[model samples]
Each structure stands twice: as structure tokens, then as C-alpha cells.
Target: MVVAACAAALLAGLTGTAHAVDNLPPDQPLVEDLQSGGKPCATGDDTVYVPTPPRLSAVLYDPEEDNQPSESSPLSGEFEAWWTDADGTVQRRDYSTITLSSGSRQYWTMPSDLPADTVISWHVRANDGHATSPWSDDGNGSVCSFVYDDTNPEQPTISSPEYPTPDEVFWVDGVGVYGHFTVDSPSDDVVSYTYGFLGGPYGTVTAERPGAAVTIPYLPLTSGPKNLTVRAIDRSGRSSSQAQYDFNVKSGRAPVARWKLDDPAGSRSAAAETGTPARAGIGATFGGPAPTGTASTTTVALDGSGHGFLTPDTSATDIRDTFAVSAWVRPAETGRTMTVASQDAVGQPGFTLGLHAQESGALWSFAIGGARLSGGAPETGEWAHLLGLYDAETGKAHLYVNGHEVGDAVAATPAEAAGAFQIGRARGTTGYRDRWHGDVSDVQVHDRVVVPTEVSEHAWRKPTLLGHWSLSSATDGASPEQSGGTPLHLAGGASVYRASDDSCIPDIDPDCTYVPPPLVGDGHLALDGESGYASAEGPVVDTGDSFTIGVVVRLADSAPAHPMTVLSQAGEHTDAFKVRYDPPTNSWQLVMPERDEAGAPERVVSQITGADGGEGPGQRLVVVYDDGTDTIKLFLDGYTNADATASLPDGWHSSGALQIGRGTVGDGWGEYLHGDVDEVQAYAGALRDEDVLGLGGETNPCLC
Candidate 1:
């Protein structure tokens, strides 16, 4: 049904060099006449020919712009192709006639089902009733081409967190969600990704190497639910079906509390008590309860006796036992003596669990028998959590509250005792004499030592209201209620709104509306201030690698260059370290004051800056530093636009405060960061360019 047409110019037996493959008919067209560039084929004489195209190459279905094929071949079509003596002119010829489409190039879309290893063939003929002549012998240009196969071809894959969860009580953990995508084909095809709620935000990630996968982290701030999707694409811009998932965001995880037994100058024993002291103390009423706009409140009425203790149950004391002691307390009045936990002997000197006045009354003293542990200098009317840990092996005792470590002390080994423990009073005499003057609740004691590292690994210590209280007129009016402590004050005129009776806006303020007193035992602090922006999230970082750290910062122009900083000890020892950017430059530079090859601190870091130029109120800046290569770069809105690098100092030491929003001991001091800093982080390694670009796309890594 196909027809071949050749012009009279074809009858010319002119020199072979004067004839072109385009002069051929439809049946024996030149390979150059075909639109498909890469394929293998044989000529009428059974001569093999390869196809090639300029500015492009054959590739596997999954082609990356950086990949190249090994074989070279021309495309296949019904006729042979050739160019006329004039530039920009081409012709095709067959056995009977020549067919040509001058000034028109061939274009074809490969079939999706094309075999991975198949090759195409093309034929050529002379338009002037002459057989196609050899290209090398004929001064005329012949079709040049190349071939391609599925070698090193990659499959369309998705990147994301292995497991994602939503809606919970707590959420601050290093368990991030990220994925790496790659290809196996070495085609010159370009690769990209499409992502969204239904798997959109297409063309977010691009492939540089055939099999190199790209990974990005995911963390949601809002405590809710959301869906996400992602897809892969090839050089031809063809996209694959999207991968999808449902993600839930919740208050991070619970803070972990570890306890160890430390002091006890001498052996201690428990006394037999009548009414269970552990259960008798002011009803367990100490903890952060939701809807209170604050941690729960407790009431304590000191009995005639000036002592209070939460005694342990009989058989509660055992050898090599690990225990945890927690109490929410508020001083009823200045210099008032109150014991939240204690143990006593009816007829002898034994271990006593309770707090006592320091020789100067400047701070409450934690003690067990003749041994004294460390305590904080709490305000006369402030609420606080006084926790204690006693480990016998390392003889290390620690205290923490709300995820921050307070101080440490050493103590003797704990032995088993057959007596009952007391609660809400210093355990001394027999009668209901020593009743505590403050409320105590959620008291738990495990039978083993809780390590400091273990506490760092868990999240529960982070406060979340899981309980409630019923306040009677007598209980609310007569007691130092929840309002008794140092009132939390916000700065910048930020007003604190009660999300509930126990919770408040987790944002910022204009003035001091929230003054979160140190909970003292835990080694961390949570903002008990007005919650702003309706979301609260923090960054997860690893400090082992060099890093540039930055926070979404607002500066007063007059502020110094480095407004905030974070420093970590190189290792177990307090030496060798790196410095990360805090704001503005938001770029990380290595400032290793101590570079000990024997113990050189491998620093890993991350930073941030304003996306929009500085002059505005809420611009964000990102800073980054690579310790391995000592490279420094800065980015606005996750784009690396600026960079600088320098040699690190030798013999650096990191045994200092990991200052936040301010420097530890230099240039930027007392300079409280102007803008709100959310999601601060440090990394253990260097981040790639694609990773940075990926963060800027509509598909945010932190999105749920």
C-alpha cells in the first residue's frame, strides 16, 4: 500500500559521490531517514549499520542525564537517508523510486513494550535509479549512528522513611523518615521525581548517577495526620506510578528517666510502719496534667511533726536493686521543710528518703542516711521535680527532671531491708508526726540502677499531661495552687493563651509571660511559655561530624555576626571539636581549637539562615559544614548560594556548654536570638547537593 516516488534527477549515473541515501525509496531508505536514533540494522547487501544523533544518545528506559551508552548505531526505517549537495536538504530512496521530506525531520516515540535488548534496522537506495553507493567511497556523507541496550539500567524506586507514625503524646527522637532512589541504566536520559499529598510536587529530585539513590528526612510539626506520595521519571520525561503512604504527627516521644544509687556512708535498714506510708501521703497529685495550662498542682499540710517521707513497701529493698524516685513539689513557704520521699526504722538508724535544709537553707539537700546528695536552690513558692538515681557499680548518683540532668553525687551500695517505707514525711518516730507540707504524686521505684546514657535514649521525661485532678474549694483556696510557682512570662508582648487548664500556647511572646523555672533533675528544658504558630518541633542532629548550625533567626542588624552557637565535647574526653553557624551567614566553618590526630574530634554539623534577604522580621537562613572535607557552605531556603572554608584549630576541646541562640564565651553573648528558632539540628556527615535541592521543593522533608 506504501508508494515510492523518485525525481528525474535520479536517472543520473553521476559520480557515486553525487548521490545521497535520501534518494532511496520507502523500501530501501537510508538509516538517516529514520527518526529513532539508536538501533542496529542491516543493509540490502547484508551490511550492518549503526545510528547516531547529535546532542542526544540512546539510553535505557530509566535514563539519567549523566549516564551514557556503550554501543553506537543509527535508527531504522523503511528507506535509506542521504543529504543533498545543498545544506539543510535531505533525501530518501528505494529500489523503484526515491521519497523525501525536505526541511522536515523524523520524530518517533519509542513503544513502552520495546524489548530491553532489541535492535532496529534501516535500508538505503539511490534516488536516480542507481543502487546505494558505499558512503566511504562516495564523497557524499552517509548516515552515522549508534546502538543502546539495557545495561546498568535502573528501576523506578521511591525514597522516604522506612516507617512513619502519626498522632502521639511525645515525638522528639532521631528516628527520621527518608528514602534513596536510583537507576541501573546508563542512558543519557534525564531522571526526576514527582511528589505530593497524592504523590505530587513532581520533578523534585533528579538523578545524577545511574544507581545513586537520594535520601531525605521527614518530620512533622503539627500534631495531626496527612498523606504523602512520590514518583520517579526517566530522560524522556516519562513518569511512573506514585508511591503513597499515610503519616501521623504527634507530640514526640516520652522523656526517659534513669536512676542510680549513690550515697549511704553506712548500711541502712527499713522500719515496720502501720499505715502504708507510700500510699498514705497526700494523694498522688504531682505531674503535668493536660488542660491545666501548667503541670498539675498539689496540696500539702504539714502535720504537727516537721517531717515527711514516701516510704517504700515492705520487701521493697533488695540487693543490686534499681529504683526511680519522682515527686512534684511546691514550697508552702520560705524555709519550710518538706520531705516527698523517705524510709525509716522504728527502733534504729536506717536509710531515710527525704529532703533536708542545707546548712545555709540556700538549697534543698537530697540524702539517704548519713550520706547527702545534690539538690537545687528552689524558690520559696516554686513548683519543681526532685528526682534521684543511685547506681552501686559505678557509684554514680544522678538527678533530672523534664529531660535535663541536674547534678551528681557518689553513694554506698544498697542492701535489702525487711521494713516498710514512709511517704510525705521524714521517717523518724512512730506517730503520724512528720507529715510533708507539699503535695507528692506519681512515685515509682524500680529495683535496679538507671544509667545516664539510658535516660538520654528514652523520651518520656519530656512532660505531657496524661493525668488530671479534682480541686475542691478547700484544696484550691487553702493550698499553694498551681499559680504559686514563678509565673511563666513570655517576651515581646506575646500573650499566653490556655489551650487547656493545663496547657498554653507553645509559641513566643512580646514580654515575660512565661518564666519556666528549672525542673533541675533532667538535663534538658521545655519551654513552658506561650506556644506560637500552632506547632512546636525541634531538630535532631549528630555532633560527631563537623557541622554548620543555623536557626530561623531575627536579628537587630546591630547584633554581632555569630548570634548563637552549639558546641559538643569531641568524645568522652573534653577535647577536639567543630563549630556550626547559628544565623545570618548560617554557614558552618571548622573552628577546631584542638586537632589531636590521636584523638581528633570528627565534627558533624548543620545550620540555617533566612531565605529572603535579611531586613525582614521572619527570614530564615541555613548554614552547613562538612568536617570530613572541611568544606563550608551557606543556603537561603535550603539553596546553597554562598560558601567558605578554613583550617580547623588544633587541640580543640568541646567540654563546654552547648550554648543555644548565643555563644559560649565570645563575640555573640547575652544576645538572645531575635527570631523564633525551630527545628535546630546537627548531622554526623556531609549532605549532598541533591539533598539540599530536595529540601527546597514543595515536598518538604518534615511534612507528614
Candidate 2:
């Protein structure tokens, strides 16, 4: 009965077939990261940049039992990740064990706060039986960069300010007159602004519109010439050129002066703000016993080892209707709360710009004022542009991280603050505490509400660059550079074979980085099927056992005289394994010869087609066999729809050579493919759906 069933199954065209294999220990499973194309390095990228989380995949089988999963040998997987430690050392962490799920084999990355530019290495191993496979290394674990692109967006353009336009000599009016310098961000991702006199400091404001206003606080008793300077800051932490407008301010103004902390070493005062500069008071000084704060290029790099601050000549600006303060901060670490800007008296009521973290949470809190309100949003160990603003007009206060509003409230700025106005440290009651850590720069203050749009624009991604493949060569051995830096190496004598005039196109997108077709083509290899075939040393298939094969082929016009052999390993015996195409049915099939429980040899055939019934010339086909899933799946031009059960048998390895294009059927090796085969890859195990689809040409991996 079993023999006839096998004969009937073989005769049924076996577009599909399945039975069962012997109950033996499973073989070493083939493993691979789940990606499209079911092929390793489908995107030809060894260094993958993961900004968030990443996933992996593998295939399992009992090779000795015809690729079947032994009931006693279920599949389990292992993973590991490593990165540079905070102490400038390397560290590796083992991931949790993963079991094979019936749905598909995959691995997920755990949430982590790996700092930018940290190199991470991860790999996986699979065991279906007593024998475990070594870590997968089809370049999947080559390297993983825990990256947050440091590429800042293009600097913005400040369009509105034709400062001191032609014959105009600007002047600061009383009662907090608004002198907005309308700006346009080149990236169009504006977030906020900091402006005052050309060299004045801490007159920053939130950007509401294209225009960023410079408020001249009215004191009812003051007068002098003050220069107004403005800089547009985009969401991605990019800042624009300073827009300066030298202007004079008459008396009747609330005391206000920008404390640009850009002075020389131990200058004892902030940078000169055109008209007036803040001075160091009694004991108020820039670091003395501690390493004195020094100019950091354009800003100040504050070391936690000291307490340093700037005491304005007078109150920088009186707290009023709309108040704002913004600065660029790069924290050295977390845990210790610190203030970047603050104003206080002996102790009544005060406000401070700072960051805090609840002891239990991993997130850093971007707090304005005090602990009463905060947001766990600011990223640590990196540069952040922070904005704290309150709008009397809207009756709201907001805190921005990298230009995006993280928290808001129906709040108001204090009507006043006494004592010495301070920068870099909170000053209240007894003395200076909560000193700033890390580097701080571009501190500015404004007397009006900053717009959210301005904050958002500041966080835009720098340039619009897509992944690119220069289809510009015709010779093999020459390397092709990818967008970010990976090079697509040519092998198997594959060369650029297309016309440069009109051939290149993003493998997937019509709008991505598309170049002219190369003299040859992008894919490293192009085969003509029958007369042309590529042979590699034995994958030495374990006959009658389970395995998987993946291939990316583009057919030309001709129809084959027999089945189109895509990948096969066969000899005269019944223990051969083959994945080929049946031209008449327009679908791919897997033929695995296995033995039944009674020790009888049988043929197991399964059919795999696409939703579109496969394709003809000019179309690509991706076919795969997975013993783990007991299924043969086919994808047409990247879309998967058809699949069938794979009934593998037990047997020893195939002694024949692993060949692409033609295979041995019966005594004669006649199933010859007759079209162009782009890529031929064999996985000793089943491949997840994405791996197959990726090689089939559906998704494009990231270039970051």
C-alpha cells in the first residue's frame, strides 16, 4: 500500500506531496536571519544599523530523517548581543532562549538604550536534536551598529531678517516690544530659536511661526544701544547662522542682558552683549577651586567636578507674561539631577531649567521649574536641544526635547526672581548647588511664547539620501559602493551587463537612488539556464532528509524541453533532493525521495506557486523548501501565495555535486533550466517568509 501511494504521488505531477520520515534524532538545523529572498546578505549589507530593535531567523530540520522534525527533537535557538561598556570596555549579553513556533522562526530584540555609535555583535545557533549547529554567520553577525544618526540636518535659513535693512537702524522699544526676526528653515523642520544682541546670551524663545521674536524687557529705568542677534534651530539639532541687527534701546526698560558664556578663560564675566555684559558678584565666579569652565568652541563644556555660573550685571530679564529659556545640553551621565539655567533668591519661589530621573525609571525627566512637573523624554549621553517656555497669551507652559513638545501645562512663569541671576547652577537660600554637567551651549532667553512648529522643525533628519547601487560597471571583480559605505562584491564572474544609458533603477523603488544601468547589470551573477550553469563544491545534501533551497531567477523567452532545474543535488540513487520548475504548470516543485516507517523508499513531491501563477520571461521567481514547516513555498516577483507540505524521507548524504541550472533525474541528468538565473542559494534549513521575500526582491534593507 505504501509503495503504490508513493507511485501514485509521483504520478500526480506532485505539484504537492507529503508522507513522513523516520523517528530519529534531528540533524543540525540550518540557520539564517529572516529577510526577503531567503538568501544571506540579500541586501549585501554586513553592518546593519539598528536604531530601535532588530529581529533574527533560522530554519530547523532532522536531516537524517529526510528533513522532518523528530517528535523527540523540537527546535530551540540562542542569541547574544554585545556592545562597548560605559567604562570604555566591551560587554556581551546572552539573549533569552527562543523556541521554534509553528507559524515561523524569528527572533526579536529586547528594548535597550544602547548609546549611539555603539558597535553591537549578535549571532544565533539552532538545535533540533542532540547536535547543535554552530552560530549562523552568513555575514548576519558581521556587525550591528547601535546608531542614532549623528548627521545633523542642513542648517536652516533665516529669511525674514534683512537686519538693519538698507537705511534702517533698529531700536529696542519699551514695554517688551516684539522685534521678531522671521526665519525659514532649509530643512523646513523648525523647532525653536535663541536670539538677543549679536553676542548676548540666554534670550532664547520657542518658535511659533517662521518669525522668532526678540523681546526687550521694559524696566522703566534703563537705556543704551543693544544689538539683536537671532539663530534658527531645527529639530535635528541643527542651528542656522546668526542674524544680527545692531540696535539702540532707550530708557524705561525692565533690566535684561544676554549672558553669552563665550568669554575667555577666567574673564570673570559673560561675553560682551554689545551694550552691557553681566559681572561676577561677591563670591559668584566661574569655576575656581574646581576646573574653571572654559569656552567649548562656541559654548561651554562644564565638568561635573566644579560649580561654575554667570552672575548677570543685573537681572537678565524680569519674569513676565511670556518667558523662555533654551540651551543645548549634552549630559555626561544620568542619576544626579542638575540645572543648566536658574534664578533664585534666599528661598521664596524660583524656577530652573534642568533634567532629572526618577530612581526607578530608565528615562530622564526634562523638568522646568522643579520636581512638581517633568517628562521622561530627553535622551541621555547625547546632545539635546531643550526649550522651556510659558505663554501668557495661551495660559500654557511647555518643555521641548529636540524640538518636540514633551510636556505642557496650564502654568505661568513667576512674576519675579531676586538675588543674582545664574547660569549653569541653581542659586537659592545658602548657595550654589545642582550644577550643570557635561557640555552646554547656545543658551538663549526670550520674553514671549515659543511656537511648537519651530521646535518640531529643529528635529528633522539631515539629508534626503536613499540606498544606492552604482550600476556603472561591466567587468567582474570590481566592487560597487552602496549608499552608506558597504560595497557589493562581485563573485562567480558576475559583471555589470546592462547598458549605462537606461538600465539602473532602485531594485524596489522608482524614486530612491536610481542610477543608469551598468554595462553589465547590478546582480553579481546572471545565468542562461541550460547551456550555462554554475557548480559549487558539495552542499552534500543528506539524502532522504530535509533541507531548503532558495533561488532568484529571471526567465527569458524560451520554454524548456523539460522541467527547469533551479537547484539540485542528485546521483543515480533514490536519495536525491531537487527543487526545479515545471514549465507546463508554471510553478516550482520540490522533489525529496524519502523512506517510509517500514524501510521502503518513496518519492515525496510538493508544488509551490505564486498568487499570480508564477511568471514568464522578465519576471523573477523565489522558491523555498522548509522541513521545519513541512512546506514548500513559492514567491512570484516578491509576492508569496502558494505553498504545500513537504514529505521528506530518511537517507544518507547525496554524493553528487551541488549544481545550479541542471540536475540528474532518474539515470539521465536532463531537467535543464532555459532562462536567466540571477541568484542561487541553498539553506541547509527552512527559511522564514521575509528571508525568501527579501531575496525575491520585495523589501530593501536600511542603509543607516
Candidate 3:
């Protein structure tokens, strides 16, 4: 009846827009997704085991055609959520219907003052600047309805790993980091634990009973760093707040030449590795000091008004055919001509690397080139990594920003012979004599060519680094390389961070925190078509019956070429009922079979779905059969598409073991499902269309 009432309101235009279907719904704004716990109703259609008036989520989307407007639309729009009160009257909730266009995941829940154990039926509608969509309906043409479960489980205490722990960096051993946890609850019901690396939506373990020590098994790890977070969930579906652990998997390489860049003023220099006497000097007045809080590194700014740069002492071996140049830079302002580093000889044998602005101040233009090769313009950013490499043996030049290769690079013009090296400004000898205006730090140079992997490894500051300039702290104008080989003196007074940092916060501590967030990955479970199955005892619904099945399925191909089964149950081929998907027509059928006189099973009554195929992907599809109406219907997303009369006959009893992802006939398996089917659920009673809508979004609670 609630479903019928919701459909009546929709068809009567309660949500505002209504369009005929011989085709698709009219192009209008609509709620693309709505759900709870970032998941669907895990228990069944009408009841969500979780507590509260219940948290509701809705994401709005506009017709693709109307999205790119010439004139900007209103920044925020109105969203209305109305519900039926216990007194049998329709009332609107007090939650604000307003949200900005840039807003994400609008949410609403029953007021804290509301009583629990009450049956609530609610519907939602979204209004873009232009118009409102039809009252939001689940694919079943009804609003979201559920009985509230307000009592939450006991708060679980995390016992392992030990809190108040500082950050650490290291490689993953065979045994990945381990976490052990336990939850204690008063109810006899079992509790489950969900853990993930990073922010999350993926559950490493969906439902595991609580134990004295709950630990996550190790899996192949990703290349970069990660944080791990975990939470506890009781049988009532309530989840405890999470505990976080921060750490990184980084390389351990020794740098060649180090420059603690902490020189305040006087003479600025970069020392050569091999103990060569050649060092760096101040070309002009050093300026532009960047204040970084993390490691409190040294920073200096230079204006393009003059040829401000560092004069390098010559060492043929240290400045040879192969080169790896890297640094951390932050532009004070963009769009102006700026050069950060260069080694230009009197002839065309050397190279010059610099930043350029596009047509506007906001855009960036980066390029690097030698006599014969050039590549890459980095994306404009306040702070970014800049890397330039040239290998004479390979005759190739490469440019990179943030570890990603930038354009197609060409041959390098052997940079071996004796030459002058400069920083912050290019050599005045070149035609492109550009002075830089920005902050620069941690300049490193290697005499040998490093591979791409090696370069990426350095992105996190790996080992065996040749020449390094940490550009950190110094007593007066003197700053020695961290390796202590080359010592340089600062000429112009440069402002920089003087505070020491904790060694535990390793790598580059740009954004360091006591407890960082965890790293998360894709959370979907892939099922192999042949062997995947989840089975359970189903609710009994005899002769007078009402059953509903809501599915979120993905096709195995662009167009499924074979039939696949979703749910089924059978006994000796005499008692059977199943749901089949036909690829040819992109149709869903709720089929019931009976044994004929020939002793073979034959189709008795089948309600074929009129829903079209390739509605794109991740669309919620529902098949509902209500004995009261003697009919079965198809609902897509949340709209009723078609219906069939008498999908079930008299004395239809479906009391048997339920098998998902495949069907069994005569004790043999057939009609196995391919592709993925998530949040597949069934209900003994009818479900409202709106309830189906809330279950449409993909659940990834741990995605960060």
C-alpha cells in the first residue's frame, strides 16, 4: 500500500516532473543516488538493521545535455524530503533542502527527538536551478520505508598496536602490519569488524564474529605509502568510531651531495661530492624565502628583475654526460618568466630548464631543452616537484613533475665538458636568459643516469642520491650538505625554518600529522561466473504472498550474449522458481516451473521485465510480485516501467533453500551468473519503490 501511495503521488506529479515512457524519462534533474551506511538495506527491502531515524544520503545529477551551461546556475539548490507521520498525515521534515551545486552527498536523518520503533515512510526530491525531478522513487515506485532500531551496541575498545604511536617509514616485510582488535557487547548477537587502508568504503572482512584477537591478513601491497583505519560493528548494524595508524613504505638510499640550505646570509654555495673544491656562489642577491611548517626546511625567493642565481664550481666528473636534476619549488606568483636551474656553456652544448605561464595567470607552461632535445611543461601549482634528466649514452632527455613523465623527449646534447652551473637564474650567455621569481628547496644532482623507477623512488627521497641540498638550517651564512662534503655560504640573508623535526616523520614531511589517514583501494568483490554462490534459508511465503527482489547487477559484456541466473531454488525439478536474465532482449524474468505429465519441468508463469538493457552501468533493477494484485512489475532505478498479470498461480509456495548467483536443476548446476551482482536482496513482503532508490549507490565506505 505504501508503494501504491508513492506511485500515485509520482504519477499525480507530487515530485513535480512527469514524462511518458515510450522511451526514457524526460531530461531533468534527479537524485542519481541515495543510500544508508554508504550501503543498501543489507537485511531486506523494508527493514535496515541499523539504528536511528536513520541517516539518508542523496546525490543529485543533472541531464548531461543541460550540465555545461553558458551562464553559471545557482551555486546551491533546494532538496525536499517529505514523509508520512504515525498519525496518518503527510508532513515535511525540518531538515534544510538547500545544498550547493558543488556540494556532495546531501544527507538527512530523523530528528533526535523522534521516538524509536516507529515505522517511517519518506520520499525525497531534488531541485536544480531549473526544475525539480519526479518525487524520488526507488525502481519500485515507492518511497523509502523502514522500522527504526535506535539502540546502538556497546562501544568497542581497540586493544592492539598501542595508541599515541608516532609515524614510521619502512618496507613491508613478508608479514604486513598487523592489527588485533576485540569488541564486547551485551547482546548475544555476534559482532563484525571492518578494516581498510586509508579512508575507506571497502571492508577487508564484511561480517566476521568478534574474537580475542582480530587481525587482517596480508595481501600484495601497493608501491607508495598508506595509512590503515578500522572500526567495529555489532549485530544491530551500529559501528564504532575508527582508530587510525599512519606509516609509509619508502626506499632507503644515501644521497650524493647534501645542502642543508639553512644558511641565513653572506655567501650562498652548493658543495661538490667527491670532495672536489668546486662549490656554488651567489650570482646576484638571493631572495624569496618559502616558509614550510612540516620539516621546517629553508626557502629563498628570487625576482625576475635581476639575474639572481648560484655560481657552481666546475668538476667534470660531477657534471658529466649523465645527469639527474631534482628540486622542490613553490611559485609565489604565476605567469611571469622564471628559470630555476641551468648549466649553459659558451656554446650550444648545455641545457636550460624553466617555467612558463599560459595565456592567463592561472595556467602553467613548463619546458626544458638542450641543443638537440626538450620536453614537458608542468601543471601550474603553488608547490610541485620538478625533475629533469639527460643521458648522453641513451641520447635522450626526459622531464617529469611529481614522478610522472611529461611529454615526448628527444636526444640530449652531451652535457659533459667543463661548464658553469647556475641556480634560480639561467646563464646570461644563452638567448633565453630568464631570472626566476619563486621559492626552491632540496636541489639534488646525480652524475649517473637514473631509470624511471629509480626516479619515482627518489620522489620519496630514495638512497644513493649523489648531490643533495636540503637547504635547511645554518648558524650564519655557512650551510653544509647533509653528507658534509660540499659546504656553501649564503650571501643575501634568507628566511627559513630553524626548528628540528622528529626523525620518525620520514620521507618528505609536507603535511605531517600525529595520526594520518589510511590509504584505501577499490573495494568491490569480483565473482567468477562458474563457482560463485551465497546461499541461505529464505523466509516462507505461501499461497497468499507478496515478494520483492531488488538487484544491482553489471552485465558480463557490452551486450550479454547468454542467459544468466540471479537467484533460484529447486527440489527434484518438481518444486522450483527462479529469476533469469536474457541477454538478447536485456530482459529479466521471474519464472516458475512445474513438472508436466512427460516428467519434465516446464515454464508455468513468468513475469518478463520490460526494463531496457545497457541503461549504462550500476543501475538498480527490481522485480516485484504482489499476490494482492496478482501481478509482477519491473522498476528501474526507481520508476515503474512495465507489469505482468498473474506472475504466480494459486498455491504458489516458495519455501526452500535460496541460492544466489546460480540455479540448480535436477541436482545439477546450470544458468550460472557472469559479471557482478551486488546488494542482491529479496523480501517476503512488498517493498516501496523509494526503498529501492536508497540501495542504488555502490558501497565503498573506506574510499579516501
TM-score per candidate, in order?
Answer: 0.30, 0.35, 0.29
Among the numbered candidates, top lDDT falls to 2
Sort by lDDT, best first: what order? 2, 3, 1
lDDT of 3 by residue, 406-440 (tens): 66667644544456555666555444366766666
**CA lDDT of every candidate:** 0.36, 0.49, 0.48
Q: Lowest summed lDDT over 10 consecutive residues: which window, candidate 2?
A: 287-296
Tens digit of per-residue lDDT, candidate 1, span 547-584: 43333333323334643332222323332333334445
The most accurate candidate by TM-score is 2
Tens-place lDDT digits, model 2, residues 1-704: 99999998787745433332233433333433333112242222344433344444445444445443543345676666677777978877765455663234655454455565455555555655445565655343433223332333344333223233323655444323334445444544455766654334446666665333323332212236555555666533456667665555443332234544555555665664532465543223332221112123445556654445555634545554566677666666666777777666556325677777567643433333333356544435445666777655555567776555665564554545755556667765665777766666546666644445544433322211222234244234433334433333433423344433444457766766543221124433344444555554444334333333445554443454456676676554532656676767766666665632222353535565531211333444444443322345555555565344443322345666666667665555556665444433333433445444554332332212
- After superposition, the stretches of candidate 1 with alpha carbons farther than 4 Å from their true spots are 1-315, 334-337, 346-349, 413-416, 429-435, 453-704
- Sorted by TM-score (best first), the order is 2, 1, 3
**Residue ranges of candidate 3 with Cα displaced over 4 Å:** 1-256, 260-296, 315-320, 347-349, 356-381, 415-417, 430-432, 460-704
Off by over 4 Å in 2: 1-269, 272-298, 346-349, 362-372, 377-380, 457-469, 474-476, 479-488, 492-497, 500-704
